[model samples]
Target: MAPSRWDRLPGGRLLGGLLALGLLAGCGHDAVRRAPPRSASTRAWPTVAPADPASANAVLMRALGLVGTPYRYGGNTPEGGFDCSGLVNYVYRDMLDLRLPRSSRDLAAMQGPRIPEDRLATADLVFFGSAGAVSHVGIYVGEGRFVHAPSTGGTVRLDRLDGPYWRDHYSGAKRVLH
Candidate 1:
C-alpha cells in the first residue's frame, strides 16, 4: 500500500522548491534608477533671466520669473491669473513675440527639438507626462531650474527640474529655436 498522505509535508518537494525560486526572483525585480546630470561649472545657473538683456536667454529667463502664480484654468493676465498653456502662450508672446497655442493639447502638438534635461536651454519648453504630451510646461532658465505658475493660491516662482514631484512627472522637453 502507498504511504499515508499525512506522512509527507503539506507541500510536495517540487512545489516547495518552485516557491523558493519565485521568492528569489521577486527579490531581484527592482528596476534600475537613472541619475540627473551634473554641471562642470562651480557656479549654479540661474533659473530665469531678465525680461530683456544682452544675453540671448533673456526671453527665457523672463518667462521663468512667472512661476508660483496661481493656476486659473482660464485666467490670462498677470494681475488676474493663468492656466498651464495660457501662461505659456502669454510668456512667449510678451517676451519673444512668439505666439503659442492656447491649450495644453494643442501646444503639445507643436514640433520642436526634444532636448534632454542636461542640454535644456533657456526658453525651451519642458513638457511633463509619460506619452511626451505637453500636459504641463515651463521655461527652462538654466542650472536645472524652471519657472512656472504652480497652482491656484500661488504666484510665479522657480523650481528645480529634479524636484521630487517634477522629476516623476517629467515627460520630455522641447525647444523652438530659430
Candidate 2:
C-alpha cells in the first residue's frame, strides 16, 4: 500500500508515533501510594469550600513569591527564611492576617474541616507523615502542586503532590481558609 498521511510528515510515521508515546509516558502513574493508608472505617470528613476566593488567591500569591527563601527550622519571615509550617503560617498571616499553629503537628491538629484530596482548594494545608503521625505541611496551590520549604539547604520551592516522596508520605489535608 502507498504511504499514508502520517508518512508525509517531516519525521514520518515512526518518529511521530515515538513522540506521541513519549508524551503519553510523561503523564505519570496511576496508583500513588499515600502513607498511613486510610481504612474503610476512616471518617468521611466534611470539605470546606473557600469562602474568600480573593483571600485564597492572595495567600497563594504570597506563598509563590517566597519560592526561593531558604529553609530555617524556626523561621517565619521572608527575611529570616522558613520551615514547612513556618512557611504556611507566614503566607496565611501575611496575606490574610490569619494566625495558624507554628508546628506541623500542631497545625495538623488545629480545628478545620478535613479536606479530601479531590476537594483540595488553594491555600489548603496538605500534611505528610508516617505511622499515623503528622510531620510536614505545605500550602496547596492547586493542580496537585504545593510550595514548601523542603529541607535543610533547600530553598522554598514548588513540588508535585503526587511526586514519589510526597505521595508516599502524604497524610491528609485541611482547610484553614474558610
Candidate 3:
C-alpha cells in the first residue's frame, strides 16, 4: 500500500511523536502565558485607525438590521438566527469586511488595548460578564448603547452600557472595523 496524502506534510507525523518529550520538558513558561483573565476590564484588540465615525456609524446601522432576529445557538446568519458572538461575527463580516472569532473566549483573547467606553464607534466589540467566565459579546452602537442578541427572552437591541447588569460585568471593548 502507498503512504496516504496525510503523510506528506513534513512535520505532521513528527509533531505527534514529540508530544511525550514535550510533556516531559514541562512547558510551564508557556502555561503561564495562557493564564485566566483576572479583571473584568482586561484588554480590547488594539489597532491603528484614522478616526472614522462615519464608517463606524454605517457599520452599526448594518448590525441593527438584524435586531429582532431569533437567537439560535451557534447560528451565524440572519436567515436562521444568531447568538451574541454569531451576531458580531456576521455584522463585521457583512458591513466592514472584517472577521471576528466565533466564540466569546476567542473574541476576548483578542484584546490588545482599550477604547474608551464613552467613545464607542461602529463595528466595535463589547464583552459582557460571564456566568462563570466570558459568556457573551456584542457589537457596540454609538450613544452608550450596544446591539446584542442578549438572552433567551430578549431580542437584539441598543442597550445602555451603564445598565446595572452590563455595567457590573463590562469586561472590555475593542474596535475592529475601519
Off by over 4 Å in 1: 1-56, 130-133
- In candidate 3, what residue range of length 10 has the lowest lDDT sum? 41-50
Best candidate, TM-score-wise? 2
lDDT of 3 by residue, 76-175 (tens): 8998788898888888788767776789878878855566765566567888775647878987765567789887766677776777689888887876
lDDT of 3: 0.74
Question: After superposing candidate 3, which stretches have Cα over 4 Å from the reference?
Answer: 1-50, 130-132
Off by over 4 Å in 2: 1-49
Our tally of clashes for model 3 stands at 1
lDDT of 2 by residue, 91-118 (tens): 8888878888899999999997888888
Q: 55-173 in candidate 1: lDDT tens per residue?
A: 33656655656655667778777777786677778877776677887776676678766676666667677777665455777776778877777666776677787787887888877
Error of 1 at 7 (Å): 83
Name the candidate, 2 or 3, with the larger lDDT value: 2
- Name the top lDDT candidate: 2
Worst lDDT run of 10 residues, candidate 1, spans 30-39
Q: Name the lDDT value of residue 123 in candidate 3.
A: 64
